[model samples]
Target chain A: MKATHIQLAHGNGGRLMRELLETLVFPALGCREAFTDASPLASDKRIPLMASDSFTVQPLEFPGGNIGSLAVHGTLNDLAVSGAEPAALTLNLIIEEGFALDTLRRLLESAGAAARAAGVPIIGGDTKVVPRGQGSGLVIASTGLGWRDAGCALDIRSVQPGDAVLVSGPLGDHGASVLMAREAFGLSSGLQSDASCVLELAHAVRDLPGLRFMRDPTRGGLASVLHEILQASGCGCELNEAVIPLRPEVSGVCQLLGFNPLQLACEGRIVAIVAVESANEVLARWQALPEGQSATRIGHLTVDRRVILRTPLGGQRYLDELAEDPLPRIC
Target chain B: MKATHIQLAHGNGGRLMRELLETLVFPALGCREAFTDASPLASDKRIPLMASDSFTVQPLEFPGGNIGSLAVHGTLNDLAVSGAEPAALTLNLIIEEGFALDTLRRLLESAGAAARAAGVPIIGGDTKVVPRGQGSGLVIASTGLGWRDAGCALDIRSVQPGDAVLVSGPLGDHGASVLMAREAFGLSSGLQSDASCVLELAHAVRDLPGLRFMRDPTRGGLASVLHEILQASGCGCELNEAVIPLRPEVSGVCQLLGFNPLQLACEGRIVAIVAVESANEVLARWQALPEGQSATRIGHLTVDRRVILRTPLGGQRYLDELAEDPLPRIC
Candidate 1:
């Protein structure tokens, strides 16, 4: 069904967002490859990739990272998960008039530090300002460009029913942290966001022939990413709720707020589908890295065309794609 | 001096904008080439170029184009003026929640038409939405990627004192049209924006040995572009008041508002510095295109370090970089 007016859910990285893009935005552009995280620039040798994203989170600064750092990590992670080494990025900022210059400086510094950490250069950018009260302080949109390695081709079509699903670390910390940071929740802990790029993880598993696909669950969190893979690969997933990694604080927050942790955002996590034979090796390599110490096998692709979750109590429940936004502007 | 807060002028594409970039952004990235319209991507055989621009025009729709077309033209024009052949573009839209779906459809259609006209593809993009009252209806950020031909290396450093200044068409129409559309100045006529991509003009002059530099006068308009060229080339400019083209309606609006037409924005215009020997040929070639029928020679670079305007009354006036925003969110 066509929407007469946009809803907040349209940006929630869920069903409404996908429907909106497929209906109003994607068909107009006539570029089908854009459905993926990044598009491959046509080349004779290496496959060049590019992706763009706009960050709009209330209270620009959040635990573990801010909008600027998120911008860099988000764009670079998109390229990294697409099997590309981020070479350069463009930062486009829309600051509200009367926004503190010091805040801008701090944000840019954070972005620069993140870029340095990731070994990528911010090669070009544009800055614009809206009148005060028209924006939520600042919005940063970053575009990343990179190139994939030779003989490292990965796609959803390569996945099979037996492929193993692995997550690099805990999920939903970013979403939960941002949620707590905004609106007074009064339930605060030492939990922080997981907002970092996983280039190291990509590097560790890039040469593996069994790696079928990789994605960073940001918006609709882990559930959305799994659903997307199912849609693309025409397969299903069977996840073990007992094995899924979730921080205690994050879980507490989700339980209190009545939010499913699987539907929350994770800025610095990687969801990889690998051949069952090489899953152990990939998990071992990931566990060796500091960013992936919590790497574990959470599930495997199934022949049934539905995502099933097996709870710790040995009960099975279907995890459908979310239709409503649990949190707005969480990323 | 450092600004404690971001001023509207800082995003005006004028003096303050340059200061903000040089002081905080450029140094952080450590990529000096980003100071240009597009940065050269590291490649073995050819220099691939990328440019990004964010459109935050008020009213969403204007006389000549909407935010969508402006986003496409603004980005591609940056690449075109940088001596790159238009290749692919990425669209990032941040729409206000509750924005009309039909309006978005219209805007996307406009953008698709513009991309088709330029023979470029919209390859990849991202979409985000802000709550109502937090955005000016819609904002579009577009990133363009292209490549420079082997021999067509153009830069401000190559410009000399004897180079001629040429503009593709009348200036200030876009700024005036948008301004008139925003407020009821009680003075209206058949004025429309000159929003277009100068790819054909760029193509006509790409092979010319004397083409030193090219830029589109968007924010801060024609005068700001001249100031930028002067800053880079360490040269001055002398413009003939009688020869600078301005539409009658635009001139009238400027008169009513006590503004200089040169300080207004032009979405689809080109200010090129070419050697005096090839200036006439370039102008003639531009005149052949429907979009450049008003191509004319307005001035020439001079050894003096100031932009001097020679009036029709035999008096000279200095043109300074705009310090205040005559129109905000003019795109």
Candidate 2:
């Protein structure tokens, strides 16, 4: 029996999952080569960063993107956020048996296109065929390697209070997209999941020595990332409610689902803590790109480690440490 | 409820898994420092290499070294085999809910002491509390990183037709010991798993330039490794059954279990592919070490990619691929 939605069958390494990846994920991820454990033994310094992560989202496919594109974007974002010049990545797929092949192919194609546009290669990866009713549809672990020189060292400690906080694009796009894609509460949204590669922005200003730190807001949304920086650098942040970017549809969907837009995850967005001297230039550069056109200055770091969010009516409140597993397995 | 053996409950990331690590794994590995995220950002010109893996043998604790020792040795071997100077490791525990905390502590103590004796520090790691009955009693992922020079690289392709093979010690000790421990096929011999860190021997000779290739006989066993090398280097292997080290009990256990000792996974042994001229010197070095007292020269390489086994009765037979998980997750 085909999995109606998220279930143990999706994650298991079986025929069901194979059909899912073959039909959904492999297509979205755009895997050109057949899956094999014996990948080509070659890596260049341009793609010196090799990172692997496994995704188990609550809902299989979400709005603006499914688990397929999310996996690709997640891996790409890791490379981009790290300041490395991403070259290529290896994808390992573990799927529950009986997943539809069409679904898997569509997802893989989407991911492949995304990767191609990002100018990164998906050279090699492995796909495990699991049993039915084991996994939901798929659980992907992609390991990416990118190249970076000593000059790319991002200092978390460099996040200074008063230094402007900027997100590459709108917040809550991916998060709201997930809720809408799930079709929960009989609701849907036109908002797109902000899942794309930041390679263009990264290379556009590879010479930007002032870019102190950059991180992708995936699980736990923009709030979680900012919180991490605050704790790491012993700093605080206060957002200007009016300036924070949010899609109209995202806001609507969040309201319908009783979810916090600030807490939703994003795949394509980048949160950069830069030196005050060049924040505007970085923002301008980001805004010039298609993926970064919606970039906005969300807030400013403070001397304290507390996080504060200002309401539309000028009310200020603290954003506490994120409750774990936000949107449970939204990665 | 003690879960002396692993159950689906161990992987739940709960109390039971904790006890296994705290009592069984940690103490066995001998880790000193509290686990953390990153292995202390490597110092100097050290090119850090980290490897993480999970072992789920049928039985909880095996003969010579249980899950605890294998976790440490496996990671250490990964770095060692890669020619990286041993430094430290971090232990990540994913245990089920009902596991005994006492067992967890005991494991941690053993892991700690082992790390100390091996001259490596146990840095910080992660512990996830999973839901009940979802996972096995314990699933451990140990990440180890060490320093290797820029020019230091071990290429499997470096193997020549005349290259010699050096077995660190006996081949089937670990596999046989696990079977004995697990009572696989209704049999048990008082055999102990040869699970120990190859660092002492690895450190004693990693600086030597002629070591062409290295691999820990895990998962797939000695034959698989030979097959891998042959395929990669376009070479073949000639094994003299008499020359290859095999414990009497290991042979007995394999014969009874309808298994081949060559295909069984091993934990402690290091299979070094080296030049014929340097093979003697390398074996001498291994023999001098306490862990390598039984070290021996096993065989030599050939141009063909096929593996040929010569039996004790002077009959020649081809060693084929293994079709089953002989010893499920022996690490």
Candidate 3:
């Protein structure tokens, strides 16, 4: 992590990435909210959340979704998790010269559909072209804006020792699918990305007084988010490994690759921390929704600042911050 | 323009770029404000503007600004031209693996300075790295949010015949400086980019009843803006080419390179349309500002849908849509 040059791990949304943001980006830019999922805009009444991310998946097209839909879903989820009502998005595209028109058309169509489904519009955008070989075929960057009533934001400060953590659905499906699609390991499990907007899940629990914090396990996956909450709140968690939801196909791919599924990405899932008394209610509401059908309580926050996983074998292990990005550009 | 593949022209912010947005992106995305500089966020009271743009300039650094400052200026100008007071920004970085850390730091510093000067903060960002050679060292895509009192937004539909067109300052400085710095044609110039934020100018005349529209002449330069106002308003223009301000060095390079300075980019300039009665007030107010000291009345909107250039030789000629991209990735 001491490397001077940018390593793939620096963009992995893991430890190195956190180091880069805290050391270089945040300090240099003086951005207080540089590490948060979304930052609240300056407002008197309802403060809107604004956040952005750049998507650069290797193959562009994958089993469950393409880069377009992934871009839309990624930005929307960031806003949703920050307790905002998704409103609008801006699409910025850096296309390689001589790229196929039909491919661009297809991607935009998917992006349009995702926006429409989420009830957001592509408001304004920019397009730039780099010479061939100087750019990936396509790179999409999106910024999402969402508004919510004041005091409804999910801040790490809100998490207390007794808060319970829950997962909306399966983990690692997105990372696994895109990795399998790349055939990097000479194997294909025919998995699909679980990329979708979870505004519905956010809405179900948005008004709940017990909701403390929420986040989407994206690039660095569930482990990264857990570490973020622990570090930010100065608290610990005892995660029940057996209760963590995992799709069999996704777990199979990770096991074969000797990768931890908990450290893999999931595009369409929510990691929620709520009062222990209301955990079951939140789970029930999420489970009633199609995207969150498998919602379950995975763990609970503690007084210390270490993440411990309670294995089904009656043993315990510390879940450290993800070191290297096993799957680069997995969106 | 009819080609099935995206050529460098499509990203030039000229005719081809317009065609792509109109025929493909806009239609597919169903965005009514797809062509505007910024879109108003949905709200019952004050409406804020949201916009995004990607910056991928060659050499990364130039005389007046680097890609980082350019990223900030470009997005802020877009929001300003749309008549909003810039509030926050999201920075998304796509870096090439192994890119120099010092270089990244310097760029971030510049970006930070620009954001601070413009009174906007870099709230959140996502960084991803592509393997070396797949990217141009670094690419920064930024999204900006600006708020305006309800009903203060500028729309192209407000343009009308007899409206005077004004240039904030010299044209083609940015495009010329970057083009010369590339040394692609074995030529170099001491000229610097006019890259800057014109929020002050935007605020000065934003409340003027005569103000119709404003735009930063970036990618396709002065000619492009003229054409855009004409096309969007379904009107014509009589541009006095002899009166348009031009820096001697920029014009020299453009002439030597067999390019039209009129089509060259100007990152810090504004092309505005205002009522003839108030054009003098707008010009005088702008000229009093440092960035707009060279401001001058350049032309007027007409009743027809054709743009005519009043040549210095006293002959009139058609000013067509930017037919080619003289310098790609200039901004």
RMSD of each: 12.5, 6.8, 12.5
Per-model TM-score on C-alpha atoms: 0.87, 0.76, 0.86
Poorest 10 consecutive residues of model 3 chain B by lDDT? B33-42
Could you give the candidate ranking by DockQ, starting with the highest?
A: 3, 1, 2
Of candidates 2 and 1, the better by DockQ: 1
lDDT (Cα, tens digit) per residue for candidate 1, span A1-331: 3445333333322234345445533332232322321112323346567778889877789989999889989998888888887777877777676666556667777887788888786766666767767776788888888887656768867899989999999999998889999969777788899998888998999889999999888777788778777766798999999999999998998888898888788999999999999999999999999998999999999999999999889999998665445466776
lDDT of 1 by residue, B1-331 (tens): 2554333333322234345445533332232322321122334445567788888888688898889889989988989888887677787777676666556667777887788888887766666767767776778889988877657758877899979999999999998999999987786778999998878888888888989889888777788778767766789999999999999999998898888888888999899999999999999999999988999999999999999899999999998766546567888
Q: How good is chain A of candidate 1, measured by TM-score? A: 0.86
Number of backbone collisions per candidate: 0, 128, 0
Extract clashing residue pairs from model 3. Answer: none
The residue ranges of model 1 lying beyond 4 angstroms of the native Cα positions read A1-45, B1-44
Q: Which DockQ values do the candidates obtain, in the order shown?
A: 0.14, 0.10, 0.17
Runs of candidate 3 exceeding 4 Å displacement: A1-45, A184-186, B1-45
Task: Give candidate 2 regions above 4 Å deviation.
Answer: A1-52, A58-72, A86-153, A180-184, A202-211, A275-277, A324-326, B1-72, B86-154, B177-190, B205-211, B303-305
